[model samples]
Target chain A: MKIIVCIKQVPDPEHAKMDAKSGTVVREGVELMINPFDLYAVEEGLRLKEKMRGEVVAISMGPPQAEEALREVIGMGVDQCILLTSRDFAGADTWATSYTLAKACQKIGDYDVIICGKQAIDGDTAQVGPGIAAQLGIPQITFVRKIDEISEKNIKAERLVEGGYEVISSPLPILITVVKEINEPRLPTLKGRLNAKKAEIAHWGPEEIAADKDKIGINGSPTKVDEIFTPDLSKDGKIFNIEQLDAAAEEIVKKQKEMGLI
Target chain B: MGIKVIKEKCTGCGICFKVCQYGAITMAEKVHTLENGKEVKRLAVIDLGKCTLCSECVKPCPTSAIELKAEAHKFEGKENYKDVMVFAEQRRDEFEEAAFELVGKGRELADKLGVNLYALILGKDLKGKGEKLISYGADKVIAISDDSLFNFLPEPYTNILIRIIKKYKPSIFLAPSTTQGRALLSRAAGKIYTGLTADCTGLDVDSSGNLLQTRPAFGGSIKARILTPNMRPQMATVRPKVFKPLDRDPNRKGEIIEEKVPADLLKSTTKFEKWIEDTTSAISIEDADIIISGGRGLGCSDNFKILFELAEILGGAVGASRPTVDEGWIPYSHQVGQTGKTVGPKMYIAVGISGAIQHLEGMRSSDFIIAINKDPDAPIFKVADVGIVGDLFEVVPLLKEKLKRAING
Candidate 1:
C-alpha cells in the first residue's frame, strides 16, 4: 500500500507579531518552522513505514526557501521531497490552496493513503486536510487520536470526541488528519541528517501540474480579507481588588450585585 | 533547498511517486544483487527541476524514505490595520454572552481605528436584541433574521457571511469561542482563505489599526500574538468570560439592516445529535462572581469537603484544574486549560495547585487570583493577586470559619 503525507512550513508563532497599522503580520525576521501538529503527522507516517515496510515521501508548498522544511523531513528518513512553489500561487485561501494541493495529488497519480496534521497552527482552521479529501473524492477521518488497525484496503482509527471517543473506519485512498495527542515525533538521527544534506528537493508550478491558472492562487481563492482591526474590550472598566482571601467570598457577592450580571 | 530523496533508502514502495505532483518522479525497475547472489527488483526514479517542494508526499512512505529540507527565504508582502467586526450571536431567543463580550471588545478596537463598529447578528426574532447591541456601542447592527437561521448550521451561515464579508470587508471579525461559533467560524475562515486565531485571551489595537490577537499556543506553554498581514478581516475567536460586556442603555439605536438566508444553502452534513442541557445550575465557571478552584495538592476528594463548604458559603461555583480531574477527584467537565474551558471570574481562589502553563492559559484573565499552596514557588503565584504558602487543608477550613464568623457578626 502506498501512502503520502502533506506538510507545511509556518511562521514560528512564538516570535510572530502583527503590524497594528496595516492589519498584516510581520513575516520578515520572524523565525519559521514546521507546524507543531505536522510533526505528529510526520511521526505517524514514519511509524507506518516501519510497520508496513514501505517508503515515505514528504510533500510541501511554499516559497523557494521552504525547501528547508522538506530537508528536515528527509533527515527524519523520508525517501523524497516535492516542493510546490510559484509566484502565481500567492494569497490563496484554504479553498484555493486545497484545490492546488488536490491538483498536485492528482498529478502524483496512484496513492493508497494520505495523512496530514489536524490543523495548521498559523491558520487554526482544520479545513485543508478535509478539503483535500473532499476534492479527491475520498473518505476522511479527522482529529484521529489513535490508529486502531490498518489492513491493505481499510483503516480503523479512534477519533477524539468531546467525551470518550468514537471508532471510525475508512477504505483505502483515504485521508486522515491527526491531533497532537496521537504521538511524539521522532528526532532526526546522525545518519538521517547526513542523508538529508545530500538530498535533492524538487519544485513544481501550475504549468507543470496542468493546474488551472484561474484556480491556483489568489485569483482562484473565493474569499478575501477586506479589513483587519484589533478587537475592543472597553466595557465600563470596573475593578474590585480583594486583598484578603478570607474576605473574598463576601466581596465577590457584593461585587456581583453591583454589576448586576447574576 | 527542498525535500530530497535518499534513493539508497528508497523501498520502491511507490509512496513518493504517488505523492509527487510535478510528475518529477517515475518508478523504473532496477535489479539489486544481495550477499547471497539473489537479485531484487525495485522501482527507481527521477530528475528534479519540475518539483515545487510542496511537501505533499512526505508522510505516506512506510520505509521512512521522505524528508523535508528548510532554507531561509522571505515572504514578500505589504502591511495593513483592518476594520473590526464581531459576530453577534443570537440563539434561543437571547444573545450569547460571548457575543456581547466580543462586541465590547470590537467597539474599543473600532474606536482605536477611527472606524465603524460592525455587529453581525443572525437569528429569529432578534430585532429587539439589535437595539441593545447599539446601546452596547455597535456602530451598526447587520441583522439577518430568518427561521432557517434558527438552527445554526454551517452552509447557509458561511455562504451568507461570505457574501456580507465580501461586500463590507471589515478588517477584523470576532466570534465567540463556543462550540457552535467555532464550528461555523473555523470553517468560514478557511472557506474564505484567511487567518484565524482561536480562543484568544486578549485583543488589542495598535496605532495602525492592526489587530493584535494573543492566544496560548504550543500546549499553552507560549503566548502567540497573531497578525495577518495583507489579509483583510483578520479573524479571531475569543473565549467567553475573557471580556466584560457594556452597560445597557434602553434608548440606544443604530442602523439595523435586514438580510435574507437562501434556502438552497441551508443544508449541512453535520447532524444535530442532541443538546444535553447544562445539568449543573452552578454558575458557569467563566461567569462565576467567585471561583473556589482545587489543585493536585488538595490531597484527595475527601479534602474538598472544606472547598465545597467554602464555595457554598461564598455562593459561588467550584472549579478544578486538569490534575484534579485526572486524579479522579472531580469530573472532567470541571477541568480548565488548553483542553478545558477558559474562565475569568471576579475572584479565583486556587488551593494547593501549582499552575502549569496550560492551566494558567485558561484562567489568567480572572479579575483577582489568590493561590494557597505549600510551595511558594508554584507558578500559580506568578499571576496570583494574593499568595499564601501553607497547607490548604489547614488554611481553607480556618479561612472559611473566619469568613462565616465575620459574616454572622
Candidate 2:
C-alpha cells in the first residue's frame, strides 16, 4: 500500500487567553501545533503502512513553518515528507489547495490511497479532501471513523452520520478524510526521531508539480474576502461577581421570577 | 512584508493575532515610559512565512494598523447570471431543516436582488417535498429523482448540480455546510471552477449585487466577509440553525418543475453497503426553552450528573461544550459548537464552561445567555446576558434549589 497523508499546522486550541483590556484573544505565546484532527490521518496512514508493509508520505500546504508539522508526521514514521510551498500558493482556498495537492500526487504518480483529516481545526471546513478527489477525478469517503478492511486494490470503512454510521467501499486511489474516532495516534519513537532528522523533505512548487500557473495560488482561488472583522458580541449583559453565592442565587431566582421567566 | 502592521496605529489589542487562522501574527512587546511615567505597549508583528495574504488581520484592527498589497484583476460575463438557487437537501424523503432555512434566506436575497428564488431537491421518492420548500418561500422548486441520489454520493450529486447550474445560470447557489453539503458543493465548485465559501453565518446581497457571505474563521475568533466576485453561481454554505426557516404558507403560489438528469452523469465510483442509524435519546436542544450546558470545569464525566439534575428541575435539556464531547464525558449529539451543532434557544445556561471561540459561535444566538464559571474573565462572559463569577459546584445547586422552589410555588 502506498499512502499519502495531508496534514496542517494550526494554533493550539488548549492554550487560549483573552486580552484584559480589549477582551480579545491574546495571540502572544499562542504556540502552533499539528491540527488535532490531522493526527488521526497520520496515525491511520502509518497503521495501514505497518500492516501492509508499504510506505506513507506526508504532505502539508502552508508556509515554511508548516514544515514543522510535516517533520512531526515524519517523526511518527511517515516514510517521506513534502512541503508544498510557494508565494503564489499563498491565499489559496480549498479549491486551489486541493488542486495543488492532486497535482503533487500526479507528480508522484504512484499512490493507492490518500488521507486527510475530516477538517482542519482552525478553518473547520471539510472541503479539501473531496475537492482533491474531484480534482483528481477519484472517489472519496469522508468522516470515516473506522476502517473495517483494506488492501492495495480496495478498502471499506464506516462513515459517521447524523444518527449513526454507514458502511462504504471504494477502489484504490480513493481519498479519505478521517475523524478522531478512527484511531489513537502513537507518539514519535527514538528511531523515528533519528530518521526524521536525516530525512530530506522535498519542497515542491507549482512548477515542480507541473501545476498550472493560473490554478496554483490566489489567482486559482475563486473566493475572496471582501471584508474581515471580529464577531463582537456587544450586548451589555449584567455581570455579578458574587460575594455571596447563596444570596446571588436567590436574587437571580427573584429576578427571573419578576421577568416572568421562572 | 506580505502584510504589514503599522506600529504607530497599533494598540496591541491582539484582535488581529486572534483572527489569524494561519498563526502568522504575534504580539511584539516594546515598552516605553511616557512623560507621566506610564508604560505603553507596542503592536503585533507579522511573520511573512506564515502569512498567506488572506488579509484576515487587516480590517479587524481598531487602529487600522495592518496593510497589504492589493491584487488587480478584471472579470466579465457575470452580468448574464440571474436568480438565486438553493440546494434543498433531503434524505429518505424528509427535507433537512437547513433546506428551508436556505430557501428562506434565498427568498430574502432574491427579493433584494430583484430575481427569483429556486430550490433543487435531489432524492428518491421526493415527489411532494418541493411543495414544502415552495411554502417556505421558493419561487420554483426543481425536483430531480433518481435512485443514485437516494443516498448522497458526491460524484453524481456534483454532476447533476453542474448540469443544472449550467442550464439555469443562477447568480448565487446556497446550501447547508453539513457533511453532504460541504462534500458535494466543494467538489461541484471545483469541477465547475467556481468558489464556495464554507459554513457562512451570514449571507446577503450587497448593493452591487454580490453575495456577501460572512463566516467565523480561526477557531471562530473572527468573521470574514467572502465574495465570489466574478463567478456565475456565487456559491456559499451555511451550517444548520444559522438562519430560521420562514413560516410555511400553503397559500403561497409557486412552480414545481420535476426534472431528470442524464444516467451517464449519475455514475458513482464508491459503493454504499448499508446504513446503521443509532437509536438516539429524545433530547432536542433546538426546540428546548432552556439549555444547561457543561464544560471541562465539571472535572469528570460523573460531574455531568450535576448539570442533568439541574436541567431536570429547570425543565430544560442538557448541552455540552465540544471539549466535554471530545473527552467522552458526553456524546457528540449533546455538543454545541461550530463542528457539532448550531443552536438557538430562549435561554442558554453555561456552567463550568470557559468558552472557546468555537463554543461561543454555537450558542451566542440564544435569546438570553447566563454563564456561571469560576473564571470571571472566561470568553463565555463576553456573550452572556448574565455572568456569575462563582464556582459551579456551589452556585449551581443553590440556583437549582431556588429556581425549583420558585417555579413550583
Candidate 3:
C-alpha cells in the first residue's frame, strides 16, 4: 500500500507578528514549523508504512522553504518527500487550498490512503481536510482520534464526538483528518537524521501538477474577508466578590436572577 | 434568492422539513429509471420565498449530503432597525455575568448609535432578575415568562426571539458565546441566513450603525474584523471573561414588555439528552489563582507527574498542552489552547510547551504567564511574562519543591 501524508509549513504563531500598516502577517524573523497537527498525520503515515511495508511520501504546499518541513518528516523515517511549492498558491482559503492539495495528490497518483491534520493551526476552520475529501469525491471523517484497524481493503476508525465516540468503517483510499489523539510522533534517531540529510526532496509546482489556475489561489476561494479590525475593550467589568464560598455563590446566583440569566 | 434542495441527495430524514419555520419544504416523489430499468423512490422538495437561508439543515444530515451555497455580500440596504439587544443568558436560576457585560458594551454602542439598549430575559418566575437588567443600563426590558425556558431549549426560544426581533427590528443582536448561546444563535441566524461573528473579543458601532465585530481569525494568529453589511439584527457572540460586567443601580427603571412563547412553536424537533451543569463550578483552571500546564516537551507521562506535584503545591489545577492530551498523558478536557478553554489567571506557568498558534489562541488572554523549557528558542517565551530557558525536567521539580517550602514556611 502507498501512503501520502500532506503537511504545511506555517508561521510559528507564537513568534509571528502581524504588520499593523498592511494588515498582513509578517514572516520576517519568524520561525516556521510543520503545522503541529500535520506532524501527527506524517507520523501516522510512517507508522502505517512500517506495518504494511510501503513507501511514504510527505507532501506540502508552501514557499520554497517548505521543503524544510518535508525533509524533517523524512528524518522521521519517511521513504520520500515531495514539495508542492509555488508563488501562485499564496492567500488561498480552505476551498482553494483543498483544490491545490487534491491536484498534488492526483499528480502523485495511486495512493491507498491520504492523511491530513483535522485543521491547520493558522486557519482553525477545520474545513480544509473535509474540503479535500469533498473535492476528491472520497469518504472522509474528521476528528478521528484512533485508527482501530487498517487493511488492504478497508480501514476501521473511532471518531471523537461531543458526548461519545463513533466507530465507523470505510473503504480503502479514504481521506482522514486526525486529531491529536491519533498517535504520538517519534523523534528522528541518529541514523534517521543522517538519512534525511542526504535525501533529496522532489519539488512540484502548478505546472507539474497541471493545477487549474483559477481554482488554485485567492481567485478560487469564494469566501473573502471584507474588513479586519480590533475589538474595542469597552465593557463594564465589575468584579462582584465577597468572603465565604456559599455567600459568593449565592451572591452570584442573586445577580444572575437580577439579570434574568438563570 | 431561494434555496434549492438536491432531491437525489435528500434522505427523507425530515430534518430540513422539521427545522423549516416558514413551512417551505414538503415531501414529494420523483420517478426515475435506473440502468436496469427500475423505478426508485426519492424525496422531493420546494424552495420557499420566505426561507431565511440560515444553513441549519446542512449539519443534521447523517449522510453529509446537504450543501449550503451562499451568495456573497448580500448586505446592501438602508439601516432600518434600532438599538442593540443581547439575550442575557441565565444559568441555574441566575443571570450570567457575561449577559450584563454584553448589555454594558451594547449600551455604549447604543448611545453612540442613538438607539435604546434592550435586554431580552426569558425564564420562569425570574421577574426580579428582569428588574436588575434595566439597572445595568438596559433602556428597555423584554421579559418573557415561561417555565419551559427555565432550561434552554431551541424550540420556543428561537421562535419567540424571531418574533420579538421582527417586531422591534433591533439593529444589533449579541449573545454570550457559551455552549447554549452558541447552539441557539447559530441555528437561529442560519435559519435567517444572516452573518454572525462568533467568539467576538470586541464590538463597536460606526456613525452609520454598522456593528464592528472583532474576533481572532487565522487561528488566533490575527484578529479579523467582521461586518454584516446587508443583514438586519447584525449578530455577534462574545466570549465570557473577555468583557467586564457592569455596575448595577436599583433606582434605574425601564419598561418591561412581558411576552409569551407561542404554544405552536414550543413543539421542538430536537431533544435534550441531559443538562450538563457548568463543570467550572466544581473546578476551573480560569478561576485558579495559579495554573500549571504541561506541554509535549515533557517527553513522557512520568514527567507530567511533576506537573501534578507543582499544581498541588500551588493549590491549582493542572492543565496540558494539546499534544500532551493526544499522548494520552492527560484528558482533552484539561487541554489548554484555542480549541480548549481560555483562561486568565494571576499566574500561568507553561511547562515544556513550545506554544503553537492553536495553543496560544486559548490562553493568550492570561494575566501573567511564565514559560519553562529546555530550548532557549521555544516559542512559549514569546508570550511568557517571565521566561525561564532551561530543562523543564530539572526546573519543574526544583520549582515545585521551592514553592512547597515557601508555602509550608
Candidate 4:
C-alpha cells in the first residue's frame, strides 16, 4: 500500500495579524510551519506505512518555500517528498488547487489512499480535500477521527459529526480528510533529519503532469474575492469583581432571575 | 474559465442543461459515426460566450465529461435571480436549530431585497415536517425527499441543490456552518461555480444587492467582510447560534413544492456504514445555553469533576480550553477555541481559564460571561461580565453548593 499525505505550509496562525486598514492578513514576519492538522495526516500515513509495509510520500503544493514543509515531513519518517510548485499555480482557490493536486495524484499513479488535513488554518474552507476527491472520482470521508480497520480493498474509519461520530467504510482508492483527533504526530529523530537533509525532492508542474493550462490556477477558479474589509466591533459590557464567593453566587442567582433565565 | 465537454465520455444525461443557470449549455443533436459504422448520439455543447465558468454542471455529469477549463474570464451577474434560499439542515430525521436560524435570517434579508424567503429541505420521507419552516418565516418551502438523502452524502445533496438553484435561481443561499452544512454547502457552491463565505458571523444585503458576509479571520483577531458581487446565488454558511429563530406562527400559510430526486443522481461513490449516535451524557457545547469551562489552571484531570458538577447543577455543558484538551484531561470535542468549536451560550462561566485570544474567540459572543481565577490579571476578566478574583477550588465548590441548594428550593 502506498499512502500519500497532503501537507501545506501556513503562516503560524498565532502570529498572523490582520492589517486593519487593508483588511488582509499580514504574514510577512510570521514564521511558516507545517499546518498543524497536516502533521497528523503525515503521522497517520507513517503509522499506516509501518503496519502495511509500504512507502509514505508526503506531497505539498505551494510556493518554492513549501519544499521545506515537505522536507520536514520527510524528516518525520516519510519515505519521499514531492513539491508541486509553479508561478502558474499561484492565486488558485480551493477548486483549482484541488484540481491541480488531483491531476498530480493521477500522474503519481497506483496509490491506495490519499490523506489530507480537514482544513487549512488560513483558508479554513475545508473544501480542498473533498474537491480533490471529487476531481479524482473517488470516495471521500472527511473529518475522520480514527481508522478502525484497513485492508487492501476496503477501509473503515470513524468520522466526526456534530455531537458524536459515525463509522464509515469505503472501498480502496479513497481520500480521507482527517482532523487532529486522529493521532499524535511524532517528532523528527536525528537519523531522520540526516536522511531528510540528503533526500532528493521531486518537483512537478502543469506540463509535467499533463494538466490543462486553463484549469491549473487562478483562471480555473470559479469564485473571485471581490473585496475584504474589517468589521466594526463597538460594544460595551460591564464587569464586576466579587470578593465573597457565597454572596457572588447569590448575586448570580438573582441576576439569572432578573434576566428570566431561571 | 470555460466549460469543456469531453465528447468521448459524454452520456447526454441532460443534467448539465438542466443545471446551467446561465443557459450556456444547450443540447444539440449530433450523429457520430463509429468505426463499425454505427450511429451514436452526442452530448450538450457549452457556448463559451455565455458560460460564466461557475462549473455548476460538472459534478452532476454522470459520465464526468464536463470540465471547467481555466481561462481569463469574469463572471457576469445574472439579473433574473430573485429571492433568498436557506438550506434547512437536518440530522437523524430532525431539523437542526441552525436551520431555523438561517430561515429567520433569510426572511429578514428577503424582506430587505423585496423577494420571497424560501427554505430547501432535503431528507427521507420528510412528510409534513417542512410546514414548520413556513412558521419560521419561510415564504415557500421546497422539499426534496429521497431515502438516499436521509444520511447526508455530499454528491447527491450537491446534485439536488444545484438542480434547485439552476431551476429557481435564488439570489442568496444560506446554510448553517455546522459539520454537515459546511461539507454540503461548500461542495454545492463549488459545483455551482458560486462564491461561498464560510462560518459567517454576520450577513446582510447591501443596498446594491451584494451579500455582505462578515466572518472572523486571523484566528478571530479581526472580522472580515467578504463580498461575491459577481456571482449569482451568492452563498454563505452562517455559524450556528448567531441568529435567533423566528417565533412559530401556526396560522402562517405558505406554498410547499415537493421535488422528486432523479434516480440517476442517486448513485454516490461513498457508502453509508452506520451512524453512531452520541449516547454520551456530553452535550454539544455549541447548543448549550450555559457553559462552564476550565483551563490549565485546574491543575489536574480530577479537578474537572467539580466543574462538571457545577455544569450538571446549572443544566449546562462543560467545556475545556486548548491546553486542558492538549494535556489529555478531556476530549478534543470539548475544546473551545479557534481550532475547536465556537460557542455562544447565554451565560459562560470561565473557571481558572486565563482567556487566551483563541479561547476568547470562541465564546466572546456569549450573552453574559463570568470569570473566576486566582490571578486577578487573567485576560478572561476583560471579556467577563463578572470577575471573581480568588482560588477556583474554594470558589467553585461554594458556587456549586449554592446553585444546588437554589435549584432544590
Q: Give one digit per residue, the lDDT tens place, for model 4 in B1-409.
A: 3457877777777877865544567887889765566666866888764444444467668888886544444556578788899999998678999989998999999999999998999888788777899988999999988878888887788788888998999999999888788777767765666677878888889898889888775455445566666677888888888788999997899999998767988777677888885644467786788899999989999999888888888888899999999999988888887667678788899999997766876777787888998897676776767788888888888778877787678
Task: In candidate 4, list every pair of residues with a backbone clash.
Answer: A214-B70, A215-B70, B54-B193
Q: Give TM per candidate.
A: 0.59, 0.86, 0.54, 0.82
Per-candidate total of colliding backbone pairs: 89, 0, 20, 3
Which portions of model 4 miss their true places by more than 4 Å? Answer: A14-28, A210-242, A246-261, B1-72, B401-409
Q: How accurate is candidate 2 locally (lDDT)?
A: 0.81
DockQ of each two-chain model: 0.05, 0.51, 0.05, 0.19
| CAPRI accuracy category, model 1 | incorrect
- Candidate number of the best lDDT: 2
For model 3, how does the per-residue alpha-carbon lDDT over B77-167 read when each residue is reduced to its tens digit? 4366777899888764578777888888888888898889999988777758777888888988898876666756544667777888888
Tens-place lDDT per residue, model 3, A109-195, is 888889988666654545566556655655565567788788997887765433334565677777877877677888988888898
Clashing pairs in 2: none
Q: For this target, which candidate reaches the highest DockQ against the unseen true structure?
A: 2
Candidate 4 residue-wise lDDT, A1-262, digit = tens: 9999999887575554434344333333336778878998999999988888888888888767788898888789999888888767755777678888888888888999999988886667787887787778677888999999998888999998877888878888999988878998999999999998999999998898888876666676655554333333223334444446666777678767765567
Estimate, for each residue in B1-409, the C-alpha lDDT of model 1 and write its tens digit: 2356655567788766754434556677878764566665775364444444344455556765665543222223223334577899754557777787888888888887888888998887785777888888887888987766675655567777888887777888889865446545656765665666667777887776667777654333334565654456677778777788888676776787776656766654332223233443355565567788898888788777677788887777778887787677876556666445556677778888797655765666677677888886676766676666677777777768766665555
Residue A57 miss distance in model 2 (angstroms): 0.5
- Fraction of true contacts retained by every candidate, in order, equals 0.03, 0.68, 0.09, 0.35
Candidates 1 and 4, the one with greater lDDT: 4
Model 3: lDDT to the true structure: 0.67
